[model samples]
Target: MAQMARSPRQLGTLIQNARLNRDLTQQALASMVGTGQKTVSRIEAGHPGTKLDTLFGILAALDLDLQLGPRNKGEPDLTEIF
Candidate 1:
């Protein structure tokens, strides 16, 4: 079941869902990722300030992995915008 995240909020929602589905508490996941509960909470809250490394760490702790693929049809090129 691969989930596509089109935005930071969507990514956070997916992470939160994954965490809850695994029956993992914020503190527990934070511990696994060598972070704090508040950090996990902020990531789950879709805080833009959250670092990419932090997000990856959380994903690793949740047993999730990242994959790169072609953009969906009609998707704008983010490279041009960024």
Candidate 2:
């Protein structure tokens, strides 16, 4: 997928969509990711201050990965040059 800037809520929406597309319920996903249904619901609701590890777990469950990149033109390219 093309990288686009998105807020946490938007990210959550994307994750929710992916989960639905995979035909997984919130509870099922939570079980797969070793979290609670309420935690998944909170994330889908875009609750602020969610732990980074929790987000990573959700992404992993959705078969997705997070990639950090420069947010501005002048930002340094931290990734190793190929």
Candidate 3:
């Protein structure tokens, strides 16, 4: 299933779900990405300071691909509603 993440929190949730589905602990995933468990935790918590390289590394480690596309205008985004 394709998940749309328009916010850091949503993106973190997606990453967390992927990691859980793979049965990988934060530490294990961090080890795969050459980062610390705290880094994984922060990423999962949607910390805005996270680097793009680190985010990409985590996505790669979890076999997840980041896709970019034009935002759909038909459906209102959460930010717009709030």
Give the winner by lDDT: 3
lDDT of 1 by residue, 1-82 (tens): 8987766677789999999999999999999999899998888877788878988999988989988788877876665433
What lDDT tens digits, residue by residue, belong to model 3 across residues 2-38?
Answer: 7888778789999999999999999999999999999
The alpha-carbon deviation from the true structure for residue 8 of candidate 2, after best TM-score superposition, in angstroms, is: 1.5
Give the runs in model 1 whose Cα sits over 4 Å from its true position.
75-82
Q: Rank all candidate structures by their lDDT, best first, as comma-separated numbers.
A: 3, 1, 2
TM-score of each model, paired residue for residue: 0.83, 0.78, 0.90
The residue pairs that clash in candidate 3, if any, are none
Error of 1 at 54 (Å): 1.5
**After superposition, which runs of candidate 2 have C-alpha atoms over 4 Å from their true positions?**
3-5, 72-82
- State the TM-score for model 1: 0.83
The weakest ten consecutive residues by lDDT in model 1 span: 73-82
- Error in Å for residue 59 of model 1: 0.9
TM-score of 3: 0.90
The CA lDDT at 68 in model 2 is: 81
Q: Which candidate wins on TM-score? A: 3
